[model samples]
Target: MTILRRLAAAAIVIGLGMTALGLAATADWRLGLIVNFRLQLLFGFMILVAIMIAVGDRRWLVPAVAGLAINAILVGPWFGFGLGTSSGESVTVLHLNLLAANRDTAAVVELLHETDADIAFLAEATASWRRRLRLVEIPFDVVATPGDVRFGIIALSRIPVETRVLGVSTFQLPTPLLSFDLDGEPITVMSFHTTSPVNTRRDAARDEQLMALSDLVSSVDGHGVLIGDLNATPWTPGMSLIEDAGYQNSLRSSGLQPSWPAGLGPFMIPIDHAFHSEGLEVIDRRTVASSGSDHLGVEIELAVKR
Candidate 1:
């Protein structure tokens, strides 16, 4: 019983601390990293409350419940929000971050063939990947930027597309901004990857890149779709900045579609995402099977709003 009490107290303290950190996420990059695990914290609090109830520990109940509520509020929007209900022309997109070290080019190629998406956006398209893809005859038109193990972005399209490569983020990685027509309407797409904010410098660079991308998205005249491994969660300032640009997160309808650290299964958090502008709405959204990459791809169908 003594041990049980100690455990309960620790849980309460840790849970409360996490809640506080998430609330103060914008204060520091490290805090923002903790905020990314809001979903995990929510689950932890839930289990904590359940244990408290079963053990008849009313003393720890109040604070534990409070922590649970705070986390619920923070992560609730990903379950569902203003989901697009537009019945207009739609296009399917597959966005993946192929791990630079993974050499299973055949599996990746097979997955791409299986999905046969209207447009496929790939990150970490290193020279090795380009060489492997070239040997095969793919059905889609491929547009790729010169990429090494550290940087690269590619787009494969079944429809006609005009693409421009933009240097983004602090490292100045190649990002593709693609333009194509969908059912007579001009639509734009940006396949981007931000620096993983593991440190202060990378965090600032990620934010700067996010702001620049948001401005670019806002400048589009008709409709736009943004997809990739953003290295930021929906609750983070990075995603909020993009949302502020008039784009809606597809996860709002798809729920918390966690797509990173592919081996973790239910323990993973969503860093990869798909967002559509005001003129376009999400018709469907889901995560694809693993292609030997640490990150699983996101499949989204977006429609032009009538």
Candidate 2:
């Protein structure tokens, strides 16, 4: 009886610790610690379950089943499943992280032709890559400013672009904000690749960029859409600021779909996202095939409410 009591106590303590670690992973700003905490929680739960099995405790099964069910509901859609319907005026937008080191430019172009998205956003692009992409006979006008090291972004549109604005001042952070007028209606779109918080300098710059971006989006005079590799998740506080600025997540309204660390096992994190203002509707969303990049591609079709 004493042995059983000691085992139960250990199990309870471990379970509580796992729960706390999971919560901390969600709340903490430090990226490394956050990842570590999540891993700890995941393994900690497994350990607790193993202990329960060893102790032959049937009562623990109830909570274990409930926890697994909740996790499934939260994470099942990340496996490239669609959650909603497309609007009648739907225009497909594809966001891809073309690894800078990739050499198969022809393959990339072929994939673009195959998908035939109405608009395409590419990150980590280089001048050579942009030149290579220009050779593809896609019916689109392309705008790109290739970067040497970091945060290179590009946008291409099949429809005629009436106006294109690049780079509005954002709290001295050099992130580009691109906007275009599509189909006689102005759609303000911004593609951002914020500094990853893994390092101190990058983290501070990213935070500043986010603050400025929130202010810019809030001040926009018309409908707007923001998309890119945010390097953060919907549940994060930084994302909360963007949500508070009146933008709705295309995924959250449908489901939380993780889209990062492509091919690094099934447990993914949602770093790439699409957030839009009230005048737009998300018709459909899915992840595209990987292109040798660490991040997977996200494709979203959105409609302007006429």
lDDT of 2 by residue, 107-222 (tens): 66766787757778888787777777777776566754544544377777776444444453353423344455544566776666766777666666666766666787897767
The number of residue pairs in model 1 that clash at the backbone is 0
Instruction: Please list the residue runs of candidate 2 whose C-alpha ends up more than 4 Å from where it truly belongs after superposition.
Output: 1-55, 58-87, 135-139, 146-151, 163-165, 168-185
* Model 1: pairs clashing at backbone N, Cα or C within 3 Å: none
Please write out the lDDT profile of model 1 over residues 1-306, one tens digit for every residue.
668767977988987997898788878988998888899889888988988888888989888899999999988767785556777678999998988888988888888889948999888887877778889877788875655544578788888788887766555667787898876898988888888999898888888988987887887777899899999988887778788889988888778889988989668989998988877777788899779999988999888777
- Candidate no. 2 TM-score: 0.75
Where model 1 places Cα greater than 4 Å from the true spot, the runs are 81-87, 147-150, 169-172
Q: Name the best candidate (by lDDT).
A: 1
Looking at candidate 2, the ten consecutive residues that score lowest on lDDT are 31-40
